[model samples]
Target: MRRLPPLNALKAFEAAARHQSFTAAAHELNVTQTAVSQLVKSLEERLGVALFERRGNQLSLSPRGMGYLPAVSDAFDRIAAATAILDETDARQITLGCGPTFAMRWLIPRLPDFQRAHPECEVRLSTTLAVRELQSQSPLPDGVDAAVRLYDPSKPEPGLMADPLFTADLFPVCAPGLAARLKTMADLARETLLEVRHAPGEWRDWLSAAGLGSMVPSSSLSFDFHAFALQAALDGAGVALARRPFVTDDLKAGRLIAPFALSLPKGGAWCLLYRPEAAGGSAFLKLRDWLIGAAMPPTA
Candidate 1:
């Protein structure tokens, strides 16, 4: 027979450890902060170990807690995944998580084609921060069926499976009006550089590739995401670095221009990521194949 702490206590402990705050975990679990605290205390007493360290206002995991979390989280995830397979209410609707810009500029537009191909399936998108992969210790969030993002194969994540969808090549893109001024790479010094806040080093990488290692833009503007940065460029605010999937339509429509032939490969592929369990589902497979097909370049 297996011995276990109270399921409610385990839930409280997991949520508190993840957020590092009783109040935040309470908000998520829809319980009082006092209740969460008591449950965690009970769990610690049951285990005969201190799961968390209370340092004034900051709460952190103890060494035992740090080591204990992954197994606990994975157990809950397995239960949730098993439960999800039994849920038929939304069987045809699959939730896909990705960055907002990729959803807006790339995925959403092509979704219509997928719908045309398989009208029975519904693709719902949940936008996440521009991260390369899910946090190492965290499971795929409860509601997310799958996710797609840039994945560096060099850093292999054990539980998740990744399938390459697109080779994201980065290059400078700006409105046609700004493009004319950027006739030569040296002329970049005359223009404002639009940058995404999370990827501050992109401009430096592109400049080094162009052999203008020390060059700086006349001025610079920063946005929280690539979508905003690209929008600023579209309004002639500045030149923003872009990947092919995000700019293909605009570049073809003459709304944007890639002034230089030099494009830097991201040293990674934008890949579809999911747990091993979801691989066999027909709905998941359809979406995966459609995404892969949509990302392919046109054939002559």
Candidate 2:
């Protein structure tokens, strides 16, 4: 039989030791700091060894703990990644990730077509809200195959492989009702513009490029998600200057309308992200091809 510490104790130790703070560890494990401390204590008692030395509200890994942590971490990460792969029996799972706006605006509308093309593939969509939530993404969870991501290509890699998918162009959009009320860029002062909090400086940069540098509207609607911003447009809340792919469905459906003929090409690009170490996955490849089909331009 395999000799092992209690699963909870091991998890507690990993989280606590990785962060060097029981509080930070508790946040990841979703347990009380005191509970995590107790679990670590229980583990040390069971093993008859001190894994960490407490030093005035902080922790330092003991000599033995320092030697043990790397191996234990690698083993757990491998077990988790493998279990995720083994859970898919029919090769039907693909864990997809994208910004809320991209998913709602670009991918979700086209998903049914994908289902028809490959009835064997089941895509599990995950809303990865740009870069802010990148770390929240775990190795494709048990059964999650792959993910699509939107990122700034100029930005450094965050470990995942980034593949060029498409260039997302930013433009001003509003409810059809609101669109009728606007006459010129100067009319923006009378309206509330929905801005993405995460993509700071984008609105200003676009406006400045248009030679309207001083046209900062006094009122605004801010949201962290593209989805929420789009929702605001649908509800006639305000105008949102968002990427084209993310608002394609709403624009096509006439729930929203483009007020400006000029579209600003953004610095960010859409990417197909996957673990470099993942073994060849036939199902994942097929899904990647299907997405590529939709992203490609007609002339290309």
Candidate 3:
């Protein structure tokens, strides 16, 4: 027989520890703050150790709590995974979480191939601007099975498995008419420079890579999302820095042209991330293999 605290107490403790706030944990668990506090206190008394240090309004994990968190979290994750396997409702469906930009410009375009290959497995995509949230959330929000993120592989997050998809290569791209005007690097000064608000450094990186760092544009336009910036560029608003994978179809269709030969490789690469246990599941493995195979270069 296994000795364990009440499941509610464990859950309350875990939620409080993760957020470091009883109020936030209550919000997450959909219970009263006082209830969360009582549950955590009950858990602490049962364990015979202080799990958190209360400093006035601030809450932080005690040394014992720090040591206990990973084990507790992993146990919960395992329970969730086991339950998922036993639950027949989700057996044929795989939930994928990804950035809105990637979903719109890259993943959605290639989804048909995946559907064709696995007609039995339904790929349910969820888009969010907060990619980190997808990885950090406990109980894996809305039963998300996996995530595709543009993140640095060298600096991986704990408790998640990451598989590299592709490195991003950025170059300036615009409509065909705009391309005709950009004969030289210095010619960028005559046009409006388009920028994605979230990735303003990409333009600077591309300029530095092309050795045109001194060139300044006459005007500039900024958009909150890459898709918006790319659309503005397609409308001849200005030249936008394009990630190759996102703009491949546009370039091939002659809707967007890369006038400069120079391209800058971004510091991060696109990758698939998921819990370690999920990696072994047949549905996830199929999707992972398909994604990696799709990223491979075609044979001559």
Candidate 4:
């Protein structure tokens, strides 16, 4: 290692040289003026050079001190910048806002994998009603670094950038017992129809696709959220209109059954939404990439 002057001495020299006054340097460094003078004197003694010209009531750098200022100042600036970066990275917590159903049905189960992979970054989740989020004119609420929501690219939200994660395909699903009662798609007309009130047209569209446009269910139940509707269906309350992402696990585990093979594409996609500038942050990018990867189909 190269020999260097004491850090305190160097700091005193730099500060005193910059202001051309030990009194001013002492004020900035929170030290006594005598201490600043002693530190600078020690630095000068070590360097074997007179660093300052001592004229009464005036202080000025010598030729050698003038030459040293730029390098010392640059080194301190670089050190400050590097420390700031370290502090920022160490404080890497992302607050994500999403709908309750998406959080419950899709994200929460898979979050452990993300946590395992990036222990340095913490993810705090906040849930809201999808209907309110979709229809709100304001930006994401305070403390929400980003959001995941259904977005129609045809009608983009102002000042927001969206990265599509998954498209939801709608299908009918219910408890296996309720499903067994239904022999075919046309048989759905005899049972209660379950729906989320915000997207009331989904049932009609699904019916029309199944060639039962004129058919109406024996009765109906409407909930405020897809999660509630799906839960009701799980309890054998009725046949819920299931979205692909929300039902994937339940369908595979036999918790719910889709009797019909038909699945209709919804109008928009579930996407990650954020301000355009947030895309540049490393924390956001990591979360975004992980979400996209999680949404991908498994390989054979």
Candidate 5:
């Protein structure tokens, strides 16, 4: 119906042009540098014009690109603004893409507090098998509003705002009943250790980081999800490496106990991810700030 090229190609060109570097645009997009170049090239081909002139390491906007920038940027901005106004409602909704174990242990218990504080808003959660990027309703997806991810602050998502919460420390744990019998991390080689299937190399990575690289076990008893592994540990079947928030309740009820003082992979912190388009929305801002504070460590 219109003379414009594909939206994806246009978006890629816009980001690349704005930054003046495909590498920077690719980093912002969470995609490959080659992908950004391909998208921009596709856009140029569709338009039958060159958007950027590459000179060694630098990228210069062509005459056509300079003229097209304002219109393209303005169009996306207008759509974003319109969506915010249309989606605004008396009842606010915050949907989080949560992991299975986190949903079971940390999130559900604290939700009552969130409801009490923001009764005007309706808070919901989505527990997907594959993380949010692969989910139907991701952080930037329609109706999702926002999502929580293990993100690094120094690294930013180009079009999305990344608000980091607290960090999670990964440590090994087991049922309290087996605590007195199993004394050291080395003892696990003889016994069954509950392995999380998704993080297949986690055990190896943890052991290596802990300076126990030479102490590889025969094999671990694996489970598809953290919940299943936690359940297996609770049954006194084996020891499991528990991540904070995910294992908070288990430790609280004396259901599980940490076996070693050495912790590995200490920076898997949770973050709130949302498109910059929703940054100005009063509801989205409130939810984003609330969640970041909500996940603050109880130890603090």
Candidate 6:
């Protein structure tokens, strides 16, 4: 340690010099006025300098005190600035787990908005095919702060907080060129039906809702990923059964069109889930609120 007066004495001198009143400095530092006076006296005695001149209740910094104030204030400011830089370097990060399909088609597309709103927060996204894996891993793998998952509301996870993001709905969507030829549900049978192999029932449910339950397509193709099937539909290869939220942007952009008005609601919904303790911090709360706000309808 270098030779210097005690930190408390230095603080007392600085506060007293700035305010020019021992009572005011005491109020600001949450100490007794006598304590401020004594600390300043000790500092002046240790430095062999007259730091203040007192007359009755009035107090003024001496010539030496006036010169010392600027250096002391500058040092404190530099210390604070350095601490802030370290805080930002060690800033808290939140990891969100989501399904690969939803991550690509929904979450990823909207993430930039969240980033812009919270530049101080760092977000790491982890995508997986098994949504259940988000909860199944002991101690939560990959430091996942929270998860967006599809779950049956009737059988929600015990003791975990679940907030509905959006429900799933199935409807037939095809490229604009292909959609122009589809005037009715009957026309669906004439186009190649692109199916998501994992969710085979979606097409059947959508067909039943469209009044084409027993109708069989002339040709069909299947893909392991919904993204793949959707891409195929976008490319005019075939008509794909689109899920709500995932297909919302495409429909809005006119890249895909639902020729018929029928839509089938699925049994499960997409939900945001996290442990109770995980929701305590400001960073996580900001992300949670942003997600909820994004899910809501826009004002007129």
Candidate 6 per-residue lDDT, tens place, 188-296, comes to: 8889999977778888887877777899998999987788999999999999987777787898899999887777888778888776656655667788999999987
Give residue 215's lDDT in candidate 2 (0 to 100).
Answer: 88
Top-down TM-score ranking: 3, 1, 5, 4, 6, 2
Q: Give the TM-score of candidate 2.
A: 0.63
Cα deviation at 213, candidate 3, in Å, is: 2.1
Clashing pairs in 6: none
Better of 1 and 4 by TM-score: 1
> How would you encode candidate 2's per-residue C-alpha lDDT over 220-239 as one tens digit per residue?
97887777887898899998
lDDT of 6: 0.81
lDDT of 4 by residue, 1-300 (tens): 989899999999999999999999999999999999999999999999999998998999999989999989977875664354346663476788889999999999999999899888888898853545767744466567788887876788777788888887899999999999998888888999998988899999999998999997999999988999999999999999988889888998999999999989877888888876566556777898999999887788
What lDDT score goes with residue 15 in model 1?
Answer: 100
TM-score of each: 0.71, 0.63, 0.72, 0.67, 0.68, 0.65
Q: For every model in order, what is the number of clashing pairs? A: 0, 1, 0, 0, 0, 0
Superior candidate under TM-score, 1 versus 6: 1
- Pairs with steric clashes in candidate 3: none
Q: Which stretches of candidate 6 lie over 4 Å from their true place?
A: 1-91, 129-142
Model 1 residue 134 CA deviation (Å) reads 9.9
Sorted by lDDT (best first), the order is: 1, 4, 3, 6, 2, 5
- Position 251, candidate 5: lDDT: 86
Candidate 1: tens digits of C-alpha lDDT, residues 32-147: 99999999999999999999999999999999999999999999988887567556655577889888999988888888889999998878888853453334423356578888
lDDT value, residue 244 of candidate 3: 72
TM-score of 1: 0.71
Best by TM-score: 3
Better of 3 and 5 by TM-score: 3
